[model samples]
Target: MKKSVKILLIVLAIIAVIAFPIIGTYNNLVSLEQKVDAAQSNIDTQLQRRSDLIPNLVSTVKGYATQEKDIFTDIANARSKLAGASNVSDQATADGELSNALSRLLVVVEKYPDLKSNENFKDLSIQLEGTENRIAIARQDYNTAVTNYNTKRRRFPSNIVSSLLGFEEKPLYKASAGAQEVPKVDFTK
Candidate 1:
């Protein structure tokens, strides 16, 4: 081949190589975004499972602990807020509210020894605890995805594709204000 033709072929090859990295970066970003979505879905599944358990819990508690309107109302309201949450921040806030409400409800339940020992309530509580653990794990997975995406979007080559695609940083799950406090569990009378 002529010298000019060979030079043109080399230039085309270089352009293709350059294009490959950008394409790969874009694909990686999309995959990372999907992982984040999947993690969020797992968290939601746990939250929904916990939510479904509440009605039975509330009904059981009411049968044993009559006139505890405030605690029940708080739990219902928190559930409503959680159901209505629109974003991660909203969900987090609602989760905190629910946690606080559940904590209060349990504290009040401690007064009723019969209720505490009731097999159904105890079973529900155990299940709720397991769901909470699942939620924590799911949240951690989501945060990991967010961190990975954010790191890529802020770094050199991937940053270019991330910027082009308008990828934004995602928020991580955080402990609520009340959650950070040490429990004042005074079991001894």
Candidate 2:
């Protein structure tokens, strides 16, 4: 090959070598982003399940604890706030509110033996607890996926591509203060 032609060939090979990993990283980032989205969807579904369970649980308790109107109203308000949440931060804050409401509601149930022993309330509480556990798992998975995506996007060469393509870092799905660990159930319901 002639000198200029050989130089062009070498340059093309170098460019191709550099391009490969960038493409791979970008693809991996996209996959991670999708995983995060799926994880978020899982969490949302679980939270919705818990939301649905709450009204039934509250009504069941209401039959036994008629005077505890404030706690029920608080739960209703928290549920409304959670349903209105639009983003991770809002969701986290609203989840805290809901958890607080639930804690109070459960405390009231603890005092009412009939409410705690009710079959329907027991079943709903168990389902709600299971759903909450699923939500916690999903949030952890989402955070892990976000970490991987953010690492790729913020790294040297991938960062260049990410910046050019507007791949912003995703926020981690953080649990609320009370939600750091699953709630402990004492009296079944």
Candidate 3:
């Protein structure tokens, strides 16, 4: 073999050795980002399902307790906030608000024996509970995905490729403060 041909082959081999890792890192980041996005989408879907169930629930409760206007207004407002949320963090915040509103509504329902016994109200309540559980699972999945993506974007080799490709770190879905506390309901009005 000619010396120049051997030199050309050696240079090509070196380029391949370096290029392969960069390509792999870029691809891996893309995959992680997609996973994060899919998880967020799942959360959004569950949130929408919960929002859709609100009107039926409100109507059922209204039939039994027409005087509880304030709770209904609060729930409607919270649903609006959730519907208008633009990002994962915003959605999480709005969801917390909605959950609080729903809890208050449930407390109000306890004052009405007739509403509790109604078939439609019971069905809607069960559906809302299931949707809430799904939302919780979806949020957990989202947070997990965000954690994985952020870790990859912050690591050494992957970070270098991530920065080069403009891959930003995703934020985790954090529970709002006081989320664990039971909402207090006062009927002194």
lDDT of each: 0.86, 0.83, 0.90
Clashes of 2: 0
Encode model 3's per-residue lDDT on 58-141: one tens digit a residue. Answer: 999988878879889989988998889887777778888889989999999999988899999999999999999999999899
Candidate 1 lDDT trough over 10 residues, lowest sum: 180-189
If both were scored by TM-score, which would come out higher, candidate 2 or candidate 3?
A: 3
lDDT of 2 by residue, 1-189 (tens): 699999999999999999898888779778878887887888788889889888888888898988878777888888898999999878988888788779777877878788788899899889878887887887888788888888888988889988988888888876667666655444433
Using lDDT as the measure, which candidate wins? 3
User: Could you arrange the candidates by TM-score from highest to lowest?
Assistant: 3, 1, 2
CA lDDT, candidate 3, residue 81:
88
Q: Candidate 3: give the clashing pairs.
A: none
User: What value does the lDDT take at residue 26 in candidate 1?
Assistant: 88
Q: Lowest-scoring 10 consecutive residues by lDDT in candidate 3?
A: 175-184
State model 3's lDDT: 0.90
